[model samples]
Target: MNLALAAAALAGTPNDSHGESISQGVDSKHILVSQAQDWVAEDRQLQKSTIEVAPSDRRLIIPVCNTAFEFNYPFASSQKTLRAVCPSSGWQIFLGISVHQSDNALRYTGNFKAGHQLTGTDVELASLSSAIAGLAGDLRAIEGFSLASAVRAGDLVMQRQLVTPIEGYRLNRAVAAGEIVESSSIDSILIASATLSAGQTVTLEQLDGARAARDLAAGKVLSSYDIKKRHQVLITQSGIPRGHPVTRANIALQDYYGKLPNDSLQNYRSAEQMQAIRNLAAGTMLRLSDLTPIDIIRKGDNVQLSVRAGALEITVTMLALENARLEQRVLLLNPESGEEIQAIATAVGQARGLSTVAR
Candidate 1:
């Protein structure tokens, strides 16, 4: 019998006869060749294709498996060989087979360095052998991909060697270390196809209030590590006494570029109603921990208590029961009525009753 018919017969193909006996185990070589043929037919979608298996030891035997055999192509570039494994017996063998080649593949038109962005003119589709056809990815979809490694002219273009482009920000001009990065400093949004060795690139939103952490060249893609948040900290222009309120006269906004202190105050408005917790020297960066809310009224101080009802307002003297900051609720004692009441501190020596007293 011919090699193809013998392989099929050994792999349990039914003969014209009803029943046959005298089974003496299956030949290992025949099983390998049969499985290789099945792999090409099923995986490669080739119908009745001819497959030539290399000859092995004629004495080699493989036990008949109750379950189906498994075949796998181990090489990525070529399907010239396959591994046949018997699941039940754990018997495995490698078999060499012939596979026809006539597939289209993309090849580089000229030598290109790593990071070179691919264009339509850079590659062309050409007929390649099936042994290496798997390395040639979808040729029509490879445009705009960047090369991860250098490739020579006429070399097969591979999917594994390409990187997809991403959108990121690029610098318009060279920025020195410690310089603040503004919106004008960004040239444009870059569609980066090149592999980034320095890490992920930055976005336009990240440039809102950022400063360069190091010297960067023009056209360089900005990474998160390359920039820091630019801070506008409130710094004391003159010595401030403890308990003194932080005002524009004693403090000024200073541009600070670097890592910011966790407690550093950024807005002057926030500091206007705060008092120094301790004596602060000139040029000290104001921090949240170094300041406390200023007291608008002190304990035992006489304050004007205003009560209003239906457009009628009456002011009376009331004694503060506790020191309180603006908008803080404070306990007050009405000297005339000798009654304790809650009022909101409005200003120095001034308190407003919580509810309108109907005259």
Candidate 2:
């Protein structure tokens, strides 16, 4: 391929045709320019630009190759030597162009508080500056974030200045002082079981179960007082003997002053079976601490033991050595072998275990 011919082919001016004789069907210059534009547009780093591409003023003519045209460099950009080549032709030409960004990156529309979550309307594109020179012109880079410090209007919002918004609970409407904070008025929640105290965070479930202990302003963060702590206790209608099951009929709601356990009296309202640990007089508050779970198997009682090993299960009558609750492990004496084996109490008077040698 002749250098003169390559110059002639690339020449934009028609009067200075040096190698016009070279085969010219498709405009290789135009194709190279188009390919160069595409290269810049597809570039991951250079895509954010307004590229102005123009053919060089010099003339060059080269043999048109059968293969596709390509750039000698991996990328094309402004003020860079864009070497377009026809691989099969073994020739290439250089062009000079410019890539410019039309505007600055992120600019604030108005003063923003430090904790305010950034939104699309809060910022807009403006002239590019060194402050935001490295930042991309993307809303996603800043949206949903808050400012690390207060930003004045028209200030450049830098990526380093932005921070992820911290998640917290807030009220949707004004809550009266001492009014119960309901689920409907809360924007977010945290789960907890304690009574609301002043400045102590409370969850919606805890609030829904309690009344406002004091006057609480609307939107004010809830404290311990926002939640009423009184809980209903199972009271005794009559003397409940030790080991006797406590039913709802014998209990009533009463204000409790102490901290309740995770398994609070609220659980017994569903009518779950619980028994007294010791004898209690009539009207005694049936605290959970004073109650023991019902015994499914009693001491010295004859119970059927389901001795199991993998898939095989065998039944043997055994005498329980001690009282056991549901799923409680109990010692049983296998009468036939005269051996005491440990078995889990499953049902009333029914125990199951794996067979073991007498000990």
Highest lDDT: give the candidate number: 1
**Native-vs-model 1 lDDT?**
0.75
**Which pairs clash in model 1?**
101-130
On a 0 to 100 scale, what is the lDDT of residue 313 in model 2?
84
Worst 10 residues of 1 by lDDT: 1-10
Residue 167 CA displacement from its true place in model 2, Å: 8.4
Lowest lDDT 10-residue stretch of candidate 2: 1-10
TM-score of every candidate: 0.54, 0.55
1-359: candidate 2 lDDT, tens digit per residue: 00111122433333434455333523655566667777756753555346555554434443455777676542434335456666765655665546655555777899976666678999887765344355646777876677767888988777767766533455677666445556777666332222232356554546664655656556655555455754665556788888788876776666554356654465455435578778889977666777777888989899999877778988889999899988989999978778998889999889888546567
Model 2 has how many clashing residue pairs?
A: 32
* Leading candidate by TM-score: 2
